[model samples]
Target: MHIMRVIVILFPLLLASSFTDACLAAEVLTLAKDGNAKAVIVLPGGATSAARETGGILADHLKQICGGEFRVIVESDLKDASVKDQRIVTKSTEPVETFILLGEGGLTKLLGATSADLGPGGILIRTFPNAIVLLGPGKTAPSDPYGTRYAVMTFMEDSLGCRFLWPGELGKVVPQRKTIKVAPINFNYTPRIRQRRIRMAMGLGERKSHGVKRLGFTDADYHYFNKAAMVTTSRDGGWANWHRLGGSLRLASGHSFGYMWEKHKDEHPEWFAVQPDGTRDQSRSPDRSRLCVSNLELIEEIARDRIESLNKSDLNSVSIGPNDGGQTSFCRCDECRKLDPPNSRKLAGGGPALTDRYIYFWNEIAKRVTEVHPDAWLTADAYSVYSAPPVLRKLHPNIAIRFVGLTYTNEEKRRQDREDWDAWSKAVKKIYFRPNVLLAGRRQGTPVIYVHKLAEDFRYLASHSLVGTDFDSCCHNWATQGLNYYVCAKLHWNPDLDVDALIDDYCQSGFGSGADAVKSYFLRLEDITNTIAEQQLKITQPFPPAVIDELRGYLDMAAAATADEPDASKRVAFLRSGLEYTDAYVAAFRIFREHEAAGGGRLLKETKQRIREALDNNWLVSRGIFENHHLAVNVATVAWGSWNYFGRYYWSDPSPEIRAKVESR
Candidate 1:
């Protein structure tokens, strides 16, 4: 009676069409009741690859949840279907039969939505009297029409209580039920960030670690997965279901045009930076070869090159920003220096102010490029000495500036970066949060869970014209920092999402009954990450033995509780292996300290043993999106330095055993 009363109140006009039928209106649209199909999944005529794939995803999941073959068909072919039940009910409530529409079609306008209403990456889900309409843009690549796919997923997630915790099939948590029903539903959503990608260098065929030693890697690297598991992890980890996990707009990142030095050095000698000594050579300077942005000829040439590239294929945006370096060089020509402002802010300590010149250069290029491609965007970074806003000029409408930021662990730096982000929002047509702050390369193989700070920062940026985000890198150490990556993605789609609820969902889905133990474990990691008062304190602080033991205790409990659930058990095992690797690194750091103080072969021996254990543990994690070996190969062996525990002895041999083991492959 309450359902009928609410239905009548909500749709007075629809009630007028069928007063008698309204009395017998179906209270719930049943897709599956008592493990039998009641509705058919329908697609519009001439469905694309995206449409078929999305429909299949919906059908597969429904079958998993409620049992019974859910058929997918184009609207035209619906009449020729050979299912058990083909009785189509238009307005009657008795002997119920319904169709689930998946995308824009002829009846979509009447159902109250169209492509125009839901723009790029927008979604609409509505339950009509006879059908449920899932509407979104028809995009085929990089998660377009993903809006439609997301609509189906959203309905299942929000209404039916499902959770996609991590990558691969093991990561899915589907609740089983014999009877699944839906009440009147109307929902709409669009991602806050245009692109929500967390790029992992180790996955997606970046390296090869076939069972034994392979080209450029040891068997320990685990960078490339085994062929059998690779299909699942790579497809999931490498952008196969990127949209379902909230990844959208894939755009190019900025970089300094450093190659111009080699390409134009002999032919166009004047295009390179001029040193203070009036030499235009890159050979002698520490910050070799910054571009001479003031040169009209150079601007014309760069514009011409970009235009030619655009002519070859389609590009959403073009990136031409400065190269990354601690003390990068810039053009010191008279024309360039004249454009520098008096109160130029320094990104590092008392750095050069190249903001005005670079801004002028970007605007000029934008003007020339847009003459032919008006919608094309020019991307650059608000970084280094030129990080401050331009005082001399305004940016063109086609320019998008990605702020180099998010050092939330450093209070002062975080404040400054946030202020600059806000300031740049006013100056540029678009702004994105592109931070190398994950520091995966620098802090290699440690749990750096800045998730709460990330949520806070992302929420702030989403409201301030922040259009997209691309973290510099991910090591795929999912067991330790999985929450950071997962939460970052969830917020990318829904800027105002509840972080606590998201964490609960993840723990519940991945850990099952052991969720409490797993939740305690990750929360402890988050606490440890946020409490580090100084990010740059170079103090060789011991990675507290007590804390390690405490976390291990939680994992042990999780392992016990999840023993019955095979899927949860696997995830717990993955996390435990990661912790072992972290503990090994910690033990090695302590032993190295003792060796430095007392100078003994025994301490060095202990350090090598710990490192060996680290490698052993790394292999287990590598099987599930962990890039521990890739990090060791990149940061530890060749780039070892006194600053890090792993790279303590590079000049001669820090740890003869570890270095030898790492380099031998």
Candidate 2:
């Protein structure tokens, strides 16, 4: 895992590279004659070896830069040496005006302390005539481990005069009298591409699965691994068909995709997911089937066969999912009833009951999987009903939990979603649950709007100590989701990332050099989008009409900013595209207000007609094409509240004109 990058410097043999160099050479000659030479070098414990190596490099560079006699010492062995020895060396050392701590450890030791001894009049209290603390090229000085490192760095820099400098800044040697602006290079670059290696067992119905397999995902999609870093894949999966497509696509991609096979529910009536009301899950009926984990035999067979099959495949791990049967009524079956007599109340919801059974079953399965593939990771989707905290299982140390938070609809619901997240976060951290947050959109709907909401969620999560956050675009059809995914992944990898700068970089990388215009346009668009969001929130609050007017004034200003951009095409396109959302919100708000005024469903028919008209408008079609085809489709899929109306009124019994317009599009 070690990578070496070297920079080489060539100095002119004949001295006159620059006037500054000539003057420095003259000063060095005079200084050397005076015999006023001083050098102090310090090295840390863990990086003592590296510090010594770097010190040699620095000494060579320094000799070239200063052209004066200087002694350089590398103290690489004191990291493990006794404190008494360190004290004796410090006390016996000659007083040197110029001191350089080669690494954090060396600097710490020179200050006569360790991190644990940070008190008043401690290390921070110590001062030298001229001191240079060198942080290694890739290493960062330790900050508050319990809080956000950026916050800690900011606090320290503001409260103390301790300047943070990067390795690049150390290339030049500075005189004791000179003042240098220490600009620390922020190490927060988001990689253009990243890969995640997943090892999990997929429970497949009868068709496949000798056991679970290892898999790889990159750029928010499944890919086959040629090496540890490189992955290749074809078409991403579609809605309601992720499992089937994910398996074959994963395998075909030359990556390890795991699975566990079981008989189809139709063939195994006894193993079908059961509901609290005794009815089976019919959501996405016929396409998806559930499994009853309340049956011990079923659980055992899944755990044993799945693990075995996975071990036999190229899969790095095994993943278990959907488990829709768990959402059905809790198994009132004699066997399940007896096992949970004292805890019946705990499994109140059909979802919770099913999740409990699945978790209990998987715990056993995880044990079996570990026996064979000790290094493999297990993934269980804590999605839907199981997304809440109390229902999720306390997984084994070897198992990892992927908390898929997709059920929430809007920002308000997302705020509530955080409560569930808090519960799950506490549980996982308390039990050392290795958790990854999966912010996903519902399969078929306008939930695409949730992407904006997710940006806020990602920011909040990044502020915490979570391992990482993964954005589920579902597939390429919803490619607009890709924009959100890319942004979230970039932020997740490095929380202190400059998102606006990233947008600029993304535009340049994806488009070309002249795309700076587009970058600027989008940045302004983002600003306006945020402004509108704030306005929407303010309007929802119990503000006076005057306050509301003030908020609208702000919105008007935002609108005006984008109204006359240099790129008329981009401006018009963006504004025209946003009009549908704006119009929809206005119409929805009007209808809601009318209903309140009349104390009933006032103008319900008129409101429905306007919404239908908006959907049927060619603008919607044009917007879809401009944004990307999948964007509209994904949004429509998640627009169930509105879709129900469109489906019934527009599709089922449409008028000739409306039908013709829709068909033309």
Candidate 3:
């Protein structure tokens, strides 16, 4: 896997290690030479949208690299092929002398490589004497095939040193060359993880923000998420390339039984949780409610609901939840408690874990659902108190669990989460991660660096039961935590990729002449987080005043190094803005904490106002260089956001008094 992305240039030896002249001699296709088009791109007959889109992207990139007119045409447009023998590509419909054929069809079948030979999400990029085969199984890619699209992106990055780091023009990195070339290549790759989902802020998935504006999030929160929606839906196709690196596997990961509560509260009240005082617990919101997992009738109803949903629609999986509120709020009914282990232990978040009962619940649903539709999948949100591994039994094969909350901040909690994941891996037939690790820096990020930890998890999980991952949100704070998402996308597709090399590529391509300094700045930031991870800190607790100065020095060095380059300089300044926010946050948080102790209303108001101003300034600074809407709602506005008032806040417009108290002074 490490050698899979080998760059076959002179410097290719650095990435691939194994080098021989045999590679050079095997080079069958000469794409361009002396700034002139040497070959035309020919798509296989009856190409799908995947083939056409990838072909167009390849053609566009080749033209940019060599300043040549690389015409893209379908195989049906080719001249009559009585000469299928030696050079079928020699007489393309276009005047080009050679052709770079797309996809695995007549050309590739003649060469002995085809899509039938590969696995799901598998890619085959073979260079023949007259054409290059780029073929893969085009399934579940938001209407595009990630396999073939990934093949094209792989070529652009490894072969041409072009990178799609972030959205917009500034994040794009393409090396200019007078000529473009390819060596003899036979590469076959399928990502280690099956469903590689990296969702950006306000993406199509999980459309709700957990008690945000709909429940009382501020005007800022509303504006931020509403605007963040632009990237995923952008007409310019900026976010499309990033989507190529991800899978569109619809493993449902939300509160699932809200409709059940709404429909059955009056008729089947026993299906719901029972409070300590014996009244059946219920809520208008599914997240605010709890379920009595021991209710056999309730389990049957859910299974029946899933089977009906499956019979009607082609949805990938249906989610089953223990819902939002934690353990103490869980059903204390005798039947449910009977499933608990004799010596139930408390987890870091407080739990005589309900994981066993939830697992029992999903396991029961799996049994019932699979009886009706054998292939129908059930997704269990193994979250909250039930987030840990079940004590009783392994999950049924038809059930896939999505483990949320990889606590990256507190060392103890993170370790427990990983251990729980390891345990859950053994107990479940299928598992994927959905960690909210990015919330470490709180909302207005400190550019928290957890690259190594993320690398470690992905590498380890790929070998385990990891089917895929759903990183909570790709916080569009590119200037701050973009590396997290960048490295995340690369590793999701291929877990064995060199983390250091990916970071080097990111720093060098985006930061230009200041690559080394920029790299150091990020590594240093990572180390800062690492050093303080054991402290069990919250929000600004990890960042120190002295460290901010040290980070500023690294940015200053990068600024000096990239002074002659506008794009690189602006990026450095963009990072500086994040650092300034971090600096301001630390100070503001300290003041708020001090005010908390002294009961100083003046100091608290001053700190909240300061945070609001800093957020506004950060958004202004990101205008030309970055996406402005992703300045988080919860973590960023912690001192004033609706998170603190989760149960009370509503999505309606705030009253003058409520807005002043929570959002303003």
Write the residue-wise lDDT of candidate 3 on 60-144 in tens digits. 7787777877788887676663235334544434466556767766766676757675666776776655666677766433433
Q: How close is candidate 1 to the true structure, as a TM-score?
A: 0.79
TM-score for candidate 2: 0.47
Q: Please give me the total number of clashing residue pairs in predicted model 2.
A: 44
Q: How far in Å is the alpha carbon of 172 misplaced in model 2?
A: 38
Model 1 ranges off by over 4 Å: 1-26, 80-96, 106-116, 139-145, 200-227, 230-253, 256-258, 275-289, 307-317, 325-328, 332-335, 367-376, 439-443, 533-542, 594-665
Candidate 1: pairs in clash:
139-145, 256-322, 256-323, 649-654
Count of residue pairs whose backbone atoms collide, per candidate: 4, 44, 12
Model 1 lDDT tens row, 1-665: 43344334323334344233432453457888898877788888888887887787777777778886788878776444322222233432324366788998655655555656565577776666667788777653344446787677666666565556544455566678887787766556566566766665543232222322222234444434323223332122233244354454545556847567778888998987776678677754334457778999999998887777667756667776766662335777889988887767654556556788789888888799889778888888888777877877888898888888768456677777788888889998778877876653234456766777788888899888887777766544455676776777667677676677677767876798899999999888767765553554322242568888999999999999988988889778777766766665455455556666786554355566665554433333332233422322222211122223344432222335644665676
TM-score of 3: 0.83
The lDDT, on a scale of 0 to 1, for candidate 3 is 0.67
Return the candidate ranking by TM-score, descending: 3, 1, 2
The global C-alpha lDDT for each of the candidates, from Candidate 1 onward, is 0.64, 0.37, 0.67
lDDT of 1: 0.64
